[model samples]
Target chain A: MLAAERRDHLLELLARQGKVVAKDVAADLGISEDSVRRDLRDLAAEGLCQRVYGGALPVSPAVADYAARQTVTPDGKRKVASVAAGLVRPGGAVILDGGTTALAVAHALPKELSCTVITHSPTIAAALLDHPRAELFLLGGRVFKHSAVTCGAAAVEAAQNVSADLCLLGVTGVHPEVGLTTGDAEEAAMKRALSARAADTYILASSEKLGTASRFRVLPWEKVSGVITDADAHHPVVEQVKALGVEVLTAS
Target chain B: MLAAERRDHLLELLARQGKVVAKDVAADLGISEDSVRRDLRDLAAEGLCQRVYGGALPVSPAVADYAARQTVTPDGKRKVASVAAGLVRPGGAVILDGGTTALAVAHALPKELSCTVITHSPTIAAALLDHPRAELFLLGGRVFKHSAVTCGAAAVEAAQNVSADLCLLGVTGVHPEVGLTTGDAEEAAMKRALSARAADTYILASSEKLGTASRFRVLPWEKVSGVITDADAHHPVVEQVKALGVEVLTAS
Candidate 1:
C-alpha cells in the first residue's frame, strides 16, 4: 500500500480497535515496523494520535485536566471499574491509584466486603467511607491539584512502606510497547513506587486509553499482571495484550 | 496459599463474625493454631484488628471517621457549613480543618467565588475541584484515615507554613467548659497548629457537639473567633458560647 494509504488504514484500525500495535500493523499491512512508527510519529505531531513505545492511541483531551477526563466515556469507566473491583479478594489489602477509573472502583466495591484500602488520592479514600467494612489508609504528600492526588518525595516514601496484595493502577495511556503511562513525571514516579510495593498490579483503563501514550511512563508491559478495560475479550488490543503474556479482562 | 492470603481469610472471618478465636481460624484455614496467633499478632500490630486473649476482634466498633461522621446529623452539618461558607470573603485564603462538617463547607462554596484554600484533608481538596477559580494547597503528613485528613508531626509542620485569612475548624465536641476537642491527640495537635496559622478561626459544629466533650482538647473557647452551628442564635448553647466572648452564628 502507498504510505498515505497505510496511514489511513492505521487510523481506521485505531478508531475501530481503540489501539494499534506497530508490529501487528506491520504484519497485517505488509509494511515495515519502522514505517508504522514513522506514521504514528507523524500522526502524533499532527495531534491526531499519541505515539507510545510500540503503538499509537487516539488523541484524548482527558490528559489535559482531571475535570475533563471525568466527563469522557463515563459508562465505559463504570464498566471497567466494576470488573476491576471484582479482582479484590475479600479482606485483602489493596493499593488504589489515583484517577477517575480508580475512584469508580472504590465506588463499585461491595459494602460488605471487608478490605484495607490504601490510596494517595483523597477522593478515593473519601469514596471508601461508604464501604463500612473497608479500612482506609491515605498516603500523604504534596497534593497534585490537577489529579487531586499526593505526589512528592514524601508521597513516594510513604508508598514504599505499604506492602499491599494488589494495586489498582489508573493510567492515562496503555500501549503494548509503551506499557502504562500518565501525565506528570513526579506522579509517574509515585505510581511506580506504589506498584513496586504491591505483589500484584493491575492497570484499570477504559477503551479510550488503549494504545494511547502519555508524557511519563509508569510500568513496562512485563511488570503489569493484567489490563482491565471495557473492551470485549476479542478486541484487537486485548489480543495484542494477551500476546504480550499479560492477562486481559473486559467488563462486557 | 501465601501467608498473606491466609491472613486475609482470617480478617474476612473477623469482619463477618466480629471476633475470631485462634483455634477456629486455624481449623477453618487448615493452618496451625500457632500460625493463626502469629497472624492475629501481625494484624493487631497493623491496627487492622485488636488482639484479645484468644484470637482477634475487629477494630473498635465506633466509626468516628469523617465518612461515618458525615451521615450523622447531616442536615445539621449542612446548615453549619452553609453559614461557614458564607463567612468567606470573595478572594481571601481559608484554612479548612478535616471532618465531615468542613467537607460540607467545601462543597457549599460558590463556584464563582475566587479564593485560595489550604487544607489537611484530601476529601476537602477534592471537593474544591468544582470551584474552577480556587487555588488549593494540600498539607502533607501521615493520613489519619478516621478523619480523612493528614496529621502527625509532618502535617503540623506543613500547616505552619500557610497563613490564611480564616480557618474553619471541625471538632468532635464543643463544650462550654471543656472547649474544642476531638478523638485523637495528634489530630487535636494538628488542628491547634492549623488554627494558630490562620488570622481568624471559626469552629463548625452541630447541636450534637454543643455540650459534648471528647478526649483531646484542641483549643480553649477563648481562642476561637466564633462558633457556627445549626441551632438558633438565641439557644442556650449559643448564649454560653457568646458569654465566653466568642461570636455565635446560627443557620436558623
Candidate 2:
C-alpha cells in the first residue's frame, strides 16, 4: 500500500477499535513497527490520535471527523459537486444517495441555498449540518455500520414519500446497458426509490468509476439525465454516454 | 414475567433472530412452552409478529418501531414532555439531547410549529422527517446503535457551533447536587457541549430521575436554567433544586 492508503487504513482501524497498538498495526498493514509508530506520531500531531505507552488512542471523539474524506478526490469531486448543486434550486426537495461522490455534491452546496435534502447517509447529513439555509430530511432504517448509511424497507418507504425536484446520485458502477450498480443490495433498493421520486437525475462520478460494475444494479444509463465528471473522463467513454442524449459536464 | 413482558421480549427476540420457536422462547425467557405459544399468539393478533411453521417471526421491520420505546416510561415521560415542548418557541432553533424524555418532547411537538431542530438521535431525526416546516440538523459522529444517537468529537463540535435558542435535555439520572447525569461518558461530554452553547437549558426529566446519579456527570445543578417535569416534582428532594434558583415548570 502507498503511505497515504496505509495512513487511511490505520485511521479507520483506530476508529473501529478506538485505539491501535504499534505491533498490531505492523502486523495488519505489513509495515515495520518503527514506521507504524511514525505514522501514529504524524496522526497525533494532527490531534487525530494520542500516542501512549505502546499504541495510540483517539484524542477526541472527533476521530469521526470528515477531514479524512475531504482529503480524497478534492478537485474532481468539487467540479462534480458544483454541477450537481447547480441542478438544485431554492424550495426544491431532493434526494441524495450515499457515497463519497454524493457527499461531494453536499459539500459544495452553497450555504445560502434553501432546499430539503433527503439522504440515507449519516455522513451526508453531517456535511449538511452547517448549511444554514438547507433543510435536511434524514431517512431512518437499519444502520449499515461500515458505510455510515441507513438501508432496508424503512429507508425505501421514507424516500418514496418524497416526490422530489431532483435526485443527485453517486453511481458506483455504470454501463451503457446495465446502467448504475453498487455492491450492496439494500442500498440498490434505496437508490431506485430515490431515483423514482425525482423529476430529474444527475450522477457525480470520477473517471475511474466508468466502465466498472459492482454486484448490484441501481439504474440503467438511460434513467440518468446527465453525467458530471472530471476533465480526463476518457474521451471515447464521454462520447459514448453523450451519444445516449445524456448531458456531460467535464471540469478542466 | 407478566404475559405482556413475555410478549414484548419474545417479539424482540424474533425481530433479532428473524424467527423464534416456542421452545426457544420458553428456554430464553424461562417460561412454559404453552405460555410462550400464548404470548406469540397474542403478538400475532396485535399484528406485530407472524406465526411461522413451529415458530414466530417479526411481521415487518415496523415491529421494531418507536412504539417499543413508549412502553418504557409512558406516563412519567408524557407528563414531562408536555412542559418541555412548551419551552420551545415557534421559529426558534432547539437542541435536543438524546434521551427518552427528549424523544418524547419531539413526539409531543406541535405539528404546525416551525423551528430548526438540532439532534444527535437518529430516532429524533426520523420523527421530524415528515414535519414539513421543521428544519433538521442531525449530528454526525460514531453512531451508538443501542441508544440510536451519534456521539464523539464531531457531534460535540457541531453542537458547540450552534447557538440555539433553547436546549431540551434528558436525564438518565439526576441529583440536586450532581445535576444531570447519563450512563455513557461520551454522551455526557456531548450533552455538556450542547448545554454550554444554548441560551436556555431545560432538563425535562421524570420524577423518577430526581434522586439518582449515573456514572457520567453532565453538569452541576446551578448551571441549569429550568427543570420541566411532572407536577409531583413537588417532593422536597426536588424543592431543593428549586432553591438553587432554577425555575421549575410542571405539567398539570
Candidate 3:
C-alpha cells in the first residue's frame, strides 16, 4: 500500500476506536510493526494523536482554549454536566474544578437549589454570580489564564482549609490504564488537591475523552468514586472500567 | 416659589454642587429650614438623594446594578482609572478592590507592562486574563453577587495572607466628613482588611462620588494614601479633603 494510504488507514482506525495499538493494527492490516510505528510517529507529529509506549491515544480536544473547547463535543459535555450536577444535594457543599465541562455543570445546576460552591476558577465564580442561592467561595493563587483557574501552592493550601460533600472534576483524558490526566501540571496538582478535600470525587468526561491520555496524571482510578460520561455504555473500555468496581455512569 | 419649582431648584443645587444643606438651601431661597427639609424628605423617598443629618447629599450611582453603574459616569471613571493605573509600577504588586471603576483600571493597564494583581473581584481577574504578564491572585470567600466580589471573614483572612505594595480601592462615596463608604457592610470590612495588607491605599473616586455617602464606612482619610478624582480641582469639597492633609489628585 502507498505510505499515504497506510497513514489514512491508521488514522481511520484511531478515529473509530479512540486508540490504536501498533501490534494489533499491524496484524489486522498485514503490515510490519515497524511500519505501524512509523505511521503512529507521523500522526503524532501532526498533533492528531498522543503516542504512548506501544500505542497512540486520541488527543483530548479539552486542551484547547476557552472558545475552542466549548465547541468540542458540546452535546456530550452537556449530558455529562447534567449528570454531575445531579450529584449535588440541596444545601450541600461541592468543590468544582475548572474547564469548559465544569462550566457546563455550573449551568446544569437547578436554579432554586441552595448549595455551597468552592472553586478556584474565576470564570466559574463569575458564572455563579447569577445563581440566586448558591454561596460561592473562590480559592486564591496564581491564575492559570489558559484554563481560567487558580493553581499554585497557595491554592492547594486554601483547598485544605475547607471540606466538601462531593467534587465535580474536569479532566482532559480518562483511560483505565493511564488513569486521570489534564494538560497542565499545576492544574493537575490543583485537581488532586480539590479531590482530597471532598468526600467523593466524580470525573466529568465527555464521550471523546474516554480512553484518551494527556500529559499529566491527576489521580489513580482507585481514588475516584465514579466516572460520568456520555460515551457508549457498551464500549469495552467503559466495561473494563466498570469491572474494576469504579462505578461508570452513562449520562445519556 | 411654588413647591414644585423649589424641589427642582434643590435638585439643581445638588447637580451643581455634590450636596445641599437644609439651612443653607432655605436661606438661599428665602424659605424656612422646615420647607427645605420637607423637600429633602420627598426627594429621598423618591430615591433622588441620600438624606443625611442637617442636609442631603447626592446619592451614589454606584449602588445601582452592574450595567446601570457602568453608565453613571463613563468619562469620569476612565479618567480616574488612568490615574490609578499610572500608580502601578512594573513588577510591583497591588491589591485591587471590586467595582466598575476598578474594572476600568484593569483595562487601563499597559499591555506590555508586567505586575502582580491580588483581588477579591472575579470580574477584575477575568478581565486580566488576556494581559500578557500579570500574576493574579484571587482571594476566596462568600460571593457578593451584587458587585461580583468576595467578602466576609474568609476574604479578610485571605487578604491577610499576602501583602502588596499598594491597594487601589473602590468605594461608592468619598467625602471630607464621611470619609470612605461602600454599599455593603461586609464589603467594607474586606476593603479595610485589604488596605491593611498593602503599604499604601488609594481610593478610586470618580467625580460624581465626591461629597456623596453610602451606608457603610470602609476607612478614614488617615488610612488612605490619596484620593484620585476627575472632579474640578477647585471644588470646595476637594480642597477641604486636601486641607485635612490627605492628598487629593485631580485626574483631568
Candidate 4:
C-alpha cells in the first residue's frame, strides 16, 4: 500500500483495536516504525489519538474541539457514533452539546429519524440543517468561538425550558467516583442543567478517558443510563464501567 | 425638492421636532394633509413613523427595532451616541451589546481611540471589522438569527472573563423601580451580566422608553449609573430618573 494509504490503514487499525504498537502497525502496513510514530504524533496533535511510549490509542469521550478531534480518530468516532445513533428513537426531542463526540453522533444519525434537537453548538446545528426528520430548536446563549458552543445564563435559561427525552453528553471525563467531568466550568454548568431536565442521559466517551479527570463535573455514573465506546477499548476499564450498572455498547 | 427628497425632509422634521401635525406637515411641504397622512402611513410600515388619531409622532422605542430606529432617527441617535462614545477614556475596555444605538456609538468612536471592544453581536462585530485602530473580541454562543447576536452560556462565560471600564446597555424598557428590561429573556440575562462586570453602566435609550416596562427586568435604578436621551425629552419621567442621581445626558 502507498504510505498515505498505509497510514490510513494504521489509523483504522488503531481505532478498531483501540491501541496499536508502532512496530506492529509499521510491519503490518510495510512501513517504518518512524513513520507510524510520525503519523501517531500528527493524529495526537489533531486530538484523534493518545500516543503512549510505543503506540497510539484512539481518542475517547470525543472531549475536544470537533474540528481538531474529528480528524484524529475518523473511523473510530464514526463507528462509535453510528452505534450510538441507532439508539435514538423518532419524534423524540434531543439536546446536543457542542463536542466532536456529539458531532460524530449527529453525523451517524439517519436522515429519516424524526426528532427535535435543541443545541448550543453551531457546528451541530449546521450538521442538522440537512436532516429532513430533525426539527431543530437552537437554544440562544453566549457563544464560545473556540468550542462553537453556547453557555452561560442565557443557555441555562433556554435549556430549563426544554425537558429533553435524551441529552447526549460528549467529550467528558468519566470516573467512578467523580461521575462525568469536562475541562471548562461554564460547560459543566450547562451540562448539569441539561442533565437535570433530560429523561435519559448517555455518555459517549472513549476508553482512554476511563481513569482520567477534567476540571468540570457534569454528572455521576448513576445519571448516565448508557455508555458507548469502540470495540477495541481496554477490557478492564469497560468492565469497571459495566459494574456501574450502565449499559455499555461497543462498536463492532 | 424631488418627491423622494421631500419625503425624506418631512420624515427628518418629524424625527427632530418629535411630532408633526398633519396640517402643519402639509403646509410645510405644500401638500394636502391627506397626502401627508398617506406618506406617514407608508413611513409607519417601515417603522419610521407613528400614526396617531390626528397626525403622526416620530417612531418611539416601543414601535421600532434597533435597525428601524437607527434609520428613523439617525441624527438624534448619532448625536446621543457620539456624546456617549466621548466618555470612553483611552486604553479602556468597553462592552457593547447588539442594538443600533450601540452601533451608532461604535460608529461615532474616533479613529485614534484605542480600546478593546467585547461583544456577542455579529452585526456589531461585522461593523467593527474595518476599524483597524480598535481591538475586537467576539463572544460566541448559539447565533440568534433575528438579532444576529449570540447570547447564552458561551457569551456569558466569555463576558465573565473580562472586566470593562464601561458597559453600554442597548435600548429597552426603562422604568423607575423596575429599572431596565428587554423583550428577550436570554438577552436580558446577558445585559444584566454585562452591567455587573462594568465599572460604569449607561442605558442608551430614547426618551419614549421612560416609564415603560418589558416582561423581564434587567437592572434596578440603583444599578444603572447613567441614562442618555434626546434633549427635547423633558417629561416628568425624565426628572424622576434624574432625581435618583443617575446622570442623564440629553443629545441636542
* TM-scores of all candidate predictions against the true structure: 0.61, 0.44, 0.71, 0.42
| Higher-TM-score candidate of 1 and 2 | 1
Across B44-77, the per-residue lDDT of candidate 2 in tens digits comes to: 8988877655666567634543443332334567
For candidate 1, lDDT tens digit of each residue in A127-200?
77657677777776667778888888877877776789999999998888788889899999999999998999
lDDT values of the candidates? 0.81, 0.74, 0.85, 0.72
Candidate 4 residue-wise lDDT, B1-252, digit = tens: 223333454565565456668886665444567877787788888888778887877777343233454566567677778778888888888888887788888777876787787776755655554466676665655555455566677667657877889988885788877778888888888888888889999888776677788898888888888988875547677788888888898887
Comparing 2 and 4 by lDDT, which wins?
2
Error of 4 at A8 (Å): 22
Q: Quote model 3's TM-score for chain B.
A: 0.71
Writing each residue's lDDT as its tens digit, candidate 3 over B64-122 gives 23334345649889889989999999999999989999999997888677999999999
Model 4 residue A220 distance off true place after TM-score fit, in angstroms: 1.2
Most accurate candidate by DockQ: 3
Q: Write one digit per residue (lDDT tens) for candidate 1, span B105-127.
A: 98778877998888888778887
TM-score of chain B of 4: 0.69
Better of 1 and 4 by lDDT: 1
lDDT of 4 by residue, A1-252 (tens): 666786678667655544567876778677788888898788889877776666765566223333323333344566677777887888887777777778878877877788877777656766665676676666555555456666788678768767788888785577767778888898898888887788988777765566668988888787788878774545776778888788888875
Worst 10 residues of 1 chain A by lDDT: A64-73
TM-score of chain B of each: 0.71, 0.71, 0.71, 0.69
Scanning candidate 3 chain B in windows of ten residues, the lowest lDDT window is B61-70
Instruction: Give the C-alpha interface root-mean-square deviation per candidate.
Output: 15.3, 17.7, 24.3, 23.8
DockQ of every predicted complex:
0.12, 0.02, 0.22, 0.02
- Candidate 4 segments whose C-alpha is farther than 4 A from its true place: A1-73, A231-234, B1-252
